[model samples]
Target: MHEFSLVKSLLRQVNEIAEQHGATCVEEVKIEIGPLTGVEKILVQEAFELLSPDLPGSDCRLTIIEVPLQAICNSCGKSIVVQNFQFQCTACGSSNIRITSGDAFRLLDVTIDTELTTGVTEP
Candidate 1:
């Protein structure tokens, strides 16, 4: 599944950051997922759980934040409101619209814990 790949990338980034900061274990990973990102939350979470142990951040927690779809009309240059997945500009009847947000899947932050003296060795 695509979710598995996405989670793998996220874990890799987190591990990289954790290593730079000398973190022994990752405690939490916050992610922002837009509604129009076309990714299922449950699937991503399941993938994260399945893949966590294999990565450096074994004990990390995944937190997902859902963002709404906001588009700007190219014709009228106004925000298009989404109701029931209907994306259309309120000010004008224009099909030419540019999506502004709600199509993003990214890691926001990573929280980690580590000992003061020893660094976490990569596995």
Candidate 2:
């Protein structure tokens, strides 16, 4: 489903980055998951586990960073933040609003080490 496609894309990018630095193994993979992205954490983790084995990085660790939902009111133009999927104007009861943040999924950073012949390096 959605997880499959997203994971496929993520794996491709991860492998490319890992190969760029002559890295034979990736130690960590950090990704940002926005609230409006509508992605399940467990499903994403499962997909990564299932898909990453065949790639360049064998023992890669996947870390997900969840972002909260934030919106702005169209009437008063007030900024409002919510932990979950709640989008309503606090100052004015306006249903007409725009999402200022959240609704994106991106690979923020990756950790790979190729110089180590025995163990991975820390920086």
Candidate 3:
């Protein structure tokens, strides 16, 4: 599945971030996924489970946040949370709506553990 490739890329990115921060271990990786992102959540989780161990921090946790599809109506200047994949605006029933979110999979943030000179770990 494409989720495997996506997860692989995500791991690589996380690893880079960890290295940049001189992290002793990666703690958590947070991501946001939308309904239209075309990636399965379960598949992504499975892929992460399969591939994350290859990285420095095998115990890194993946946090997936589901975001709602949201849009703004151009006609009425109203913000709406789209339901059932409906493109029409709810406030004014306008088809001229601009999607504001829920269109892609995005990396939100990464938490990494760093070692202090005093021989202690901090995040």
Candidate 4:
């Protein structure tokens, strides 16, 4: 599944971030996945769970937030929230449309448990 590759990339980025901060373990990872991203949430989660132990961030949990696809109708000048893979405009039944969102697959944030030395000072 494509989700495997996607999760692989995501975990790689997480590993980089954790290493940058000298983290001992990753606590959580939050990501936003749009409907038009073509990545299935269930498959991604399964892949993450299956691969978490072997990665740098062991025992980390992945949280996915689904975003709705939106488009602007070219013919009717209407804003449409696409549902069920329908690209037609709701206002004038126009097929001409420009997608605005719902094609995003991005990592929002990562929470990590970093090692702290005794009385470490920050600049």
Candidate maximizing lDDT:
3
Candidate 1: Cα lDDT at 43: 98
**Residue 89 CA error for candidate 3 (Å)?**
0.2
Residue range 1-123, candidate 2, lDDT tens digits: 598899899989988888888887888889988778878989999999998886664777899998777788889988877544556676787867888767778899988868766676677
> In terms of TM-score, which candidate is strongest?
3
lDDT of 1 by residue, 37-115 (tens): 8889999999999878854546678899987787889998888756566777767877788877778887899888877
Each candidate: what lDDT? 0.82, 0.82, 0.89, 0.88
Residue 91's lDDT within candidate 2 is: 74
Worst 10 residues of 3 by lDDT: 114-123
TM-score of each: 0.81, 0.79, 0.91, 0.80
Task: Kindly indicate the candidate among 1 and 3 with the higher TM-score.
Answer: 3
Worst 10 residues of 1 by lDDT: 114-123
Per-model root-mean-square deviation over C-alphas: 4.9, 3.7, 2.2, 3.0
What's the lDDT for residue 107 in model 1?
A: 86
- After superposition, the stretches of candidate 3 with alpha carbons farther than 4 Å from their true spots are 118-123
* Model 3 agreement with the true structure over 1-123: per-residue lDDT tens digits: 799988989888988888898888887889999988889999999999889887675688999999999999999999999999989999889999998889888999998877678876666
